[model samples]
Target: MKDIRKYDLAIIGGGAAGLTTATHVKRCKDLSVIVISKDAHISYSECGIPFKLAGKVHDFDSLIVKTPDFFDKMGIDIELETEALSIDILNRKIELENCDILFDKLVIATGGKQRIPQPLQKYIGMDGIFTIQTLADGMKIESALLSAKTMVIIGAGAIGVETAAGIAKRGIDTTLINRGPAILSRLIDPDMAEIVSEFLKSIGVNLITGNIPDSIEGKERVENVLISGERIPADIVIISTGILPDVELAENAGISTGELGGIIVNEHLQAFVDGNFSTDIFAGGDCCEITDFITNKGTLVQLAPAARHMATIMANNICGKDTVLKPLLGPSIYVAGDLLIGSVGLTSKRARSEDIDVITGYATGVTKASYFPGSSDIHIKLIFSDDRLTGAQIIGKSGVKERIDSLAFMIKKKATIEEMLSIETCYAPPVSTVVDPLMYAIKDAFRKIKART
Candidate 1:
C-alpha cells in the first residue's frame, strides 16, 4: 500500500497535443503534471519527419523545437525515453515498461504509431520497409536512403506527396504509388491534385495514380513491387498510406471507444467512462475523434494542428474551466516541391458523398499581383452548395498558406459566398493582390452557385 508515484495530471504522450496540454497546465498550482514520452525530446514536430529525410533538416537535433531544460523551466515534469505499456484505470495506475505510476487525471496523448498496411506486419520488421511517424523513423529512413538508390512510396496523402518530392529532389529514383484515382484523393479535388501530380512528374519523379502494388516482390529484402503483374524495382518502401489511432491503453482499461477505434470523447474532452465524464479521464489527438466542421460527422483526422487545438480544449476542461471545442473546418496544407498545396472546409468528393448537389468554380490565377516579380500561377477550386461556400483549394506559391487559413476562417464562420467575395484583406504587390485569390475563387463559386440555382 506504500505509494511511490503520484501526479495531479499524467499526460501519456509528448508529441504536439501532449505538450500543449502539459504547457497549458504548467502554471496551475492545483495540477502536478508529468508527461511520459518514449522520445528523447519533449516538443518536436512529427510531420517534419519527411522533410528531414530530404536533407532539409541537418539532423535529428534541428527538428527539435525545445529541450528537456525547457520543460524543466516551465515546471512541467517530463519523463523522457520512458514507454508506457498499459493503463489500469480501476487502480488509477499506469504500468510502464520500467515502473508503475498513479495519476489523479489521465491524459492519453500517444499520438499514433506509423501503421504498416494490413497483412504486411510480418514483413514490416524486414529492413528497408518504413513508416514515418516518429523521430526515430526519420533517422532510420535517412540511414536507409544512404544505401538505397531507388524508392517507392505507397499512399497519396500529404506524407506520400512530400516524401516523393523530397526523394526526387535528392536525385534518387523515386516513384509514388497511389491506389486512389488522384493524388490527395480525399483532401483535394482531382483538378487540384492534378496540379500536384503534374509538379511531381515535372521534377523527374515517377508518378502512378489509380494504381496499387499487388505485392512486395522481394523474398528476403524489398527488391521490387508487383503491380499490374509487372515487377517494378525498388530499393526502399515507405508505407505512407495513413495513420490509425493508438487505442490499446483505452480498450484495456475498459474505456469506451468510438468509430475506427478512436477514444470516444465529449465536448468537454472527457472520456465516456462509466457512461459519463466523471471518470476523471480525458483524451484527444490521434487517439480521439472530433466533429468535422462541414459535415458534422465524426472524423479521424490525426493532423498535428488538429491535435494542438484539441489540446487547448482538453487543458481548459481539465482545469474545471467551462470551455467547448469548436468543430474542425479541415484547414490543412501540404508542400510538394515549390507548391504550397492547401485546402479548407469541404472538398468536391465530400459534397457528393452527402448527396448535396454542388457547383464548383476553378480559376488559374496569380499568387500575387500579376505584374509583380515571382508571381506564380495559383489554381483555386471552390465548391458550393447553392451560394454557400462549402469548400475551397489553392495550388500556388507564396500565398498558399495564408489564403488557406483565411478561407478556413470563412468556412468555420459559415460565411456565404457574398461575405467571402468581399473579405477585406491587406493587399500588397509582393504578398497579395487587391483582389485576394480566395475572393476570386469565391466569386467564381458564387457565379456557379447562381447558375445551379
Candidate 2:
C-alpha cells in the first residue's frame, strides 16, 4: 500500500481562493494544511495579465502576490505541479498520480478554465494561438507579441476588450471580433457599451461587432482570420470567449452541480451531494455556484475579489465559526484606454430574460464641477424594477469604480429610487459635482416612476 499523507485541511487548487483559504485557516487554527496545484506557479494575479501586456504593469513577476517561500514562512505546505486525480468523499482521501492525501476537511477551489468555443478547439495547440487564463498563458502571449505585427482577439468580453486596448496601444494592429452586436453584451447595456466601443476605435482597435471568426488559416502558425468572407491578417490570435468552472473532480466524486455547471454549495460554502450538504467538504472560488443578489438564483461569479471573499467565509466555517456568504451582486470594473468602465447586477437584457420589468434612468455629467479644471465626462445608467434599484452601469475617466460600488450596495439592500433620492452626498470642486451624477440618475428614475403612477 502506498503511504498517504494526512492533513487537517487539503485545498485542491493554488489559485487565489485556495491560497487565501490556506492562509486564513492558519490564521485561525494551528492545523496541518496543504495546497495542491497542477500548475507550476501559484498566487499570481490572473487579472493583471492584460495590464502587464499593455506595459501598465512593469513585469509578470510583480503580479505574483506570494511565493512558495512566503507560504512556507507562514507554515503552509504547498505541492506545486500536483494534480488531484479523484476524490473519495466517504474516505476523505484524494487520489493523486503517485500518492494519496487524507484530510479531516477538504476544500475544492479548482478555480476555472478558459472557454474555447467548439469551432476554435482544433487550433488550440497551434502555434501563435493562445488563451490568457494563467500566468504561463500570459507569458506565452507576451513572448509571441515580441515578433507579431498584427493581432486578432476573438470575443468582446472584458478580457477581449482590455487585451485589444492594451495591444493596440502598443502600436500593434489589433482587431477585436465580437459575435454580439455590442461589446460586453453581458456586463452593460448596448448604449453604454457604445461609449467603450467608440473609445476602443479612437485608440486604434479595429472593432468588428456582430461577427464570428469563420476559421483561423495558417500553414504551421496563424496567418490570418476569416470573418464573413473577409480575411483579416493576423500574426497571432487570442481566444477570450469566457471561463467555465472546473468541476470535473467534484462531479466525479458525486458532488451535485447547478445548471451553470458549477459545484452547488450552500450559504455556508458547504458542498452538496445528491441534494444534501456535506459537512467535511467545502468549495469556493470560480468552481462553486453562488446566488445572485437581485434574482436569488444560482450564478457564477469568476472575479478574483469574489473568490477571495468566498474563501474567507469558507475558512470561517471550517474554523467552527457560523458565518454565511451573502448573495453577490457580481460587480465588475475594467480599464479601456483612459476610461474606467463599471457595472453591477443585471443589464436590461438580462433583466428581461429573467422576466423582470425594468425601467432605466440615464444621466451624463462631469466627474467634477463643469467648470472645474481636469473634469472629465461621466455617463450613468440606473435600472430599476418595481421601484427598487436592481442594477447600474457607469463609464468615465474617474469616479466610475466608487459609483458602481455604491450602486452595488444599494442593489444588495434593495434600495428604492425614493431612498436613493433622499441620500446625502459630498461635493468638492476638484473631486465631484454638487449634485453627483448618481443623484441625477436617481432623480430621473423617480420622475419616470412618478409618471407611471
The best candidate by TM-score is 2
TM-score of 2: 0.98
> What lDDT is reached at residue 337 by model 2?
70
Looking at model 2, residue 254 earns an lDDT score of 98
lDDT of 1 by residue, 1-453 (tens): 434588889999898889999988775445788899888666777778888887787888888888889888887888889988778887889887667788898898877766666756666777678887878788888998998899999887898999899989999999898887898987898878888888899998898888878888676789997788877788999888887888877888888888767888887778877777644798989888878777887887688888888888888878877788777775888887777888887788888888877778777777678888888888888877756777888887667787778767766777777777766778778877777666666677777667766
Q: lDDT of all the models against the reference?
A: 0.81, 0.93
Estimated TM-score per prediction?
Answer: 0.94, 0.98
lDDT of 1 at 428: 79
Where does candidate 1 stray beyond 4 Å? 1-3, 424-426
Model 2 C-alpha lDDT per residue in residues 364-386, reported as the tens digit of each score: 98988878899999999999999
Can you tell me which runs of candidate 2 are displaced by over 4 Å? none
Model 1 / residue 326 / CA error / Å? 1.7
